[model samples]
Target: MQDCRILITRPEPENTLTCERLNTHGWSAVPLPMMEIFPLKDTNKKAVIRAQIFDIDTFDYVIFVSKNAARLACDWLDECWPMLPANVHWIGIGQGTTQTLLNEGVPALSNPGHTTETLLDWLKPARMRDQKILIIRGEGGRPELGNKLEERGAKVSYLSLYERKKPQYSAQTFFMLPDINLIWITSGESLLNLSEYVSLHKPEWKVLPVLTPSIRVAQQAKKMGWINASCANGADDNSMIKATEFHIGKQND
Candidate 1:
C-alpha cells in the first residue's frame, strides 16, 4: 500500500481531503476528479431551494442524501432559519452526512449502513402515511429513494441545491494515467464518467484496479466493462482507505 499510487476520482475539495489522508497513510494519492460540484445559479431555482430550506420545519422528515447535500443545504438553512425545528426528524444516509449535519449545528439520525436501500429498510417500519418528506441533494441523482418513500405513503419533495458535472482533464494528467495502480470511485456517476473518459483517452487502462464504496457502484463498473472493480465497506474516507489496503495486501499475497 505504501508503494501504490492511488487515483482518487471524487469531486474537488472532498478529493483534496481524501488525497491528504491517503498521503498521510503512506500511499501516493493522485487526484483525478471525474466530477465537479457546482451550486445552482438560476435565481428561480435558488429561491426555491432557499424557500425549501427556510420552510423545512413544515416537513415531517428531512433526509440528506450525501455530505454535499447536507453541507450545501445547511448553508441556506443557516441563512434563513435562525433555529432548527426540534420536531422534524432528520435522516441522513450515513455517518458522513450525519456528521456534516452535526458540524452545522444540526443533529440528525443515520444508520451505520451507507446505502439508500439500507436507509429505506430502516424506515420501513416507521409510520409514513401522508407524512411530508423533504430530500436535499444534488441535481439529477437516483430517484429510487424518493420513489420508495412515496410508496410508503410519504409525500416526497426534493431540493436540488447543487449539480454535478464532468471535469476537464489536462494533457499532463492523461500522460500520468498509466502510472495509476488503483482508482477509488465514490459514486456511480463518477465511475461512469471515468469509464467514458478512459474509453476515449486511455482504453487500455480499463484493467486498472478500481475500488467503489458500494456493491451497486461495483456492479455499475462491471457493466461498463471494468473487470477489476471491487466494493469497499462504505463511502467514508476510513472505509475506503482500509479497503484499499486490504485489496493491495491480497494482491501482494
Candidate 2:
C-alpha cells in the first residue's frame, strides 16, 4: 500500500459509496462531503412542485439532473403516479442519476455521455419544437439545458427539488486523516467548495493532484490554476478507480 489518502468530495450517500470502493482498492478515502443537499422549504415552490406532480402526465418529457433530484422528485411523484405516465420520456443525466431513479422507481434513460451538453447533442431541434419538458434539479442549477430547449421551441419548466450548500467543518475534521495527496471531484461546484475548504486548512494543497469526472471539469480546475488535474471520464466507482490507478502509477514512474 502506498498509504496515500484520496479525497472524495461527492455529496453524501454517494460520498459513502465512493469511499467504500476506494478503501477496497487500498487507498484511504477522506469522506469530507463538501456540499449538503436539502429539499426546498419555500411554500410557493413546494406548492408548484406538488401541482406538477398532479399534472405529471401532461408533460412530454422529464429530466433528472442528479441522484438527489431523482430521489426527491420521485418521492413527490409517488403519491400521484401509481404507475409512471406513459409516453413521457424520462431522462437522467448521469449513470448515477439513472441508477438512483431506477431505484426510486423512475425509469430513466442515459443516452451516452452524462453532461447537459451531451444531452443537447443527442436532442434534435425538430424533436423539441412544441414539446413540453420538465427539468428536475437542485435550486440554481445550470440553465443551459432548459434555455437551449426553450430556444429550440420546446416549452421548458424547471422543478427545483433541492438546494446544495457547503457543509461546515471544524479544524478537527482534518486531524484524523493523513495528508490528502489526491482529490476526486465530479462537478465544478464540488471543486469550488473543496478548494475553499482546503485553502482554509492546507493552502499548499493547490499543488496536489486532482481527478475530475470529465474533461470539462478538469479544465475548470486548470483555469483556476490548479496543478495536475486529470479527467476520469465518469463518476462511477470503476472509472474513478481506474483513473486513480493510472495517476498513481504515472506519479511513481
Candidate 3:
C-alpha cells in the first residue's frame, strides 16, 4: 500500500476525505477530481427544488441518489420543513448516502451495492404499487431508477438540487497521470471524464488499472479501452480500500 499511488476522481470535499483515508492507510492518494458540484443557480429551477422540499411529506418514499443529493436536500428540508414526515420512508442508494441521511437526522435504508439496479432489487419485495416516490439527485442524472419504479406501479417525481460538471484542470495535472498506480472512479460520468482527460493528454496511460464502485462504471472504462478495470463491492471508503488491496494483490501475484 505504501508504494501504491491512487488517483481519486471524486468531487471536492469527498475527494479530500478519500485521500486522507488512503494516506492514513499507507497509500499515496492523489486528488484528481474529475467533476465539480455546484448549487442550482437558475432562479426558476431553484424555486422548483425548494417547492419539492416544502412538500416532501406528500411522497411515501424519498430516495437520495448520492451523498451530495442527501446533503443538499437536507439543507432545503431544514429551511422549509420544521419536521420530516414520520411516515415517509427514506432510501439511499449506497452506504455513503445512507450515512449522510442518518447524519441529517433522517432514518434511511440502503442496499449492499451502490448501483441503481441493486436499489431496485432491494425494494422489489416491498409494496411499490401506487406509492408516491420522490428522487433527489444532481441535474441530468440517469432516469432509469424513476422509470423502473414507475413501471412497477409507483408514482415517481424528481427534485434536482445541484449540477455536476467536469472540472477545468491545467495541462500540468496530466503530466502526473503516467505515474498513477491505479485510478479510482466512483461514478460512470467520472470514468468517462477521466478517459477524455487521458485520451487528450496521455493516451498511453489509459491502460493503467482502474477500480470503480459499480459494474456499469467498469464496463464504461473497458469500453473506453481501459484493459484493467474492476468493480468494487460499493462506493464507500472501505470498498475502495478493499478494491485497492485486491488490485495490488493481483499485481504482486
Candidate 4:
C-alpha cells in the first residue's frame, strides 16, 4: 500500500473514471476538474457536411489526434459517405484513438507514443511526403503536427470538431488542500485552466506536483508555477498509473 491518494484535475466525468481506476489500486482519488469541454458551434457545418459527401479517393490520409476527434469524424463520415474507401490511409495519434477507429470499422495505424512529436517521428520522411492529409482535432490544439507535415511538403487541412471551455467550480474543489501530493493534469489546457482558476478564486488546491502525459504539458505546468511535474511516457491508463506510482514512491522515500 503506497498511501498515495491522488487528485485528478481532468474535467468532470473523466475524473470519475480515473477515480474508479485508483480505487481498484486501493488509493483515494480526489477530483478537482480544471476545465470543461463543449461542442464548437461550427459556422461551416454545411460545408463540412457537403465535403463529407465527396468520394474518399479525394484524400490520401485522415489523421485523428484524439478519441473525441476520431469519434466525431467517424460519425460525420458515416452519415455522408456510408461506405469508406479501403484505399484511404487512417492515422491515429495513439492506441485509444486507434481503438476508436477500429471500433468504427476503420483501418488505422496508431503512433507508438501519444504525443505530437512521437506521431511525427513515426511518419518521418517516408510516409508524410506528398500526402493529402485531413486532420480532425479540437480547436486551439498545437499546430506543430500540421506545421511539421507541411514542412515535409504534405498537404494538411485541419477540421475543428470541438471546443474546450473552463468548467464551473465545485464546492469540493474549494475544500481541497492547497498542496495535494499529486495533481493529475491530462492536458495542457487543463493545466492552464487550473492556473486560471487559482488566479481567480485562490482555491485551497494551489501549487502541486503535476502528473502529465506529455513534455509540453509538463512545461506548461512549470510555466504556471507548478514546481513539480512528471510527464508520463504515454497517455495510456497503465502509463498514468505507473507514473503516479513512481512520483508517489519518490515522495515517500
Name the candidate that leads on lDDT: 3
Name the lDDT of candidate 3: 0.88
Candidate that scores best on TM-score: 3
Error of 1 at 213 (Å): 1.5
Model 1 weakest lDDT span, ten residues long = 169-178
Model 2, residue pairs in steric clash: none
RMSD of each: 1.3, 1.8, 1.3, 2.7
Error of 2 at 225 (Å): 2.4
Number of the candidate with higher lDDT, 3 or 4: 3
List candidate 1 segments past 4 Å from native: 170-172
TM-score between candidate 3 and the true structure: 0.96
lDDT, candidate 4, 129-197, per-residue tens: 788888888888889989999999999887777777887785565656443566777777778877887
Q: TM-score of each candidate?
A: 0.96, 0.93, 0.96, 0.86
**For candidate 3, lDDT tens digit of each residue in 1-253?**
4679998999978999999988989898889999999989899998898878888998999999999999888889889978878989999999999999999998998886788999999889989999999999999999999999999999999998899999987778787554888888899889888888888887877788888888888888888899988899688888889888887887788
Q: Write the per-residue lDDT of candidate 2 for residues 1-253, one digit (tens) a residue.
A: 3777988888988899889878887889988888899898999988988998887788999999888888888889887778888888899987878888888877789858767888898886348999999998998999999999999999998888899999888767866667888888888898998778777777777898888878889999988768889888777667788888888898799
User: Stretches of candidate 4 above 4 Å error?
Assistant: 1-3, 41-50, 53-56, 170-173, 176-179, 200-207
**Which 10 residues in a row give candidate 4 its minimum summed lDDT?**
171-180
As for lDDT, the candidate ahead, 1 or 2, is 1
lDDT of model number 2 = 0.84
Q: Cα lDDT of all candidates, in order?
A: 0.87, 0.84, 0.88, 0.76
Question: Where does candidate 4 clash, by residue pair?
Answer: none
lDDT (Cα, 0-100) at 153 in candidate 2: 92
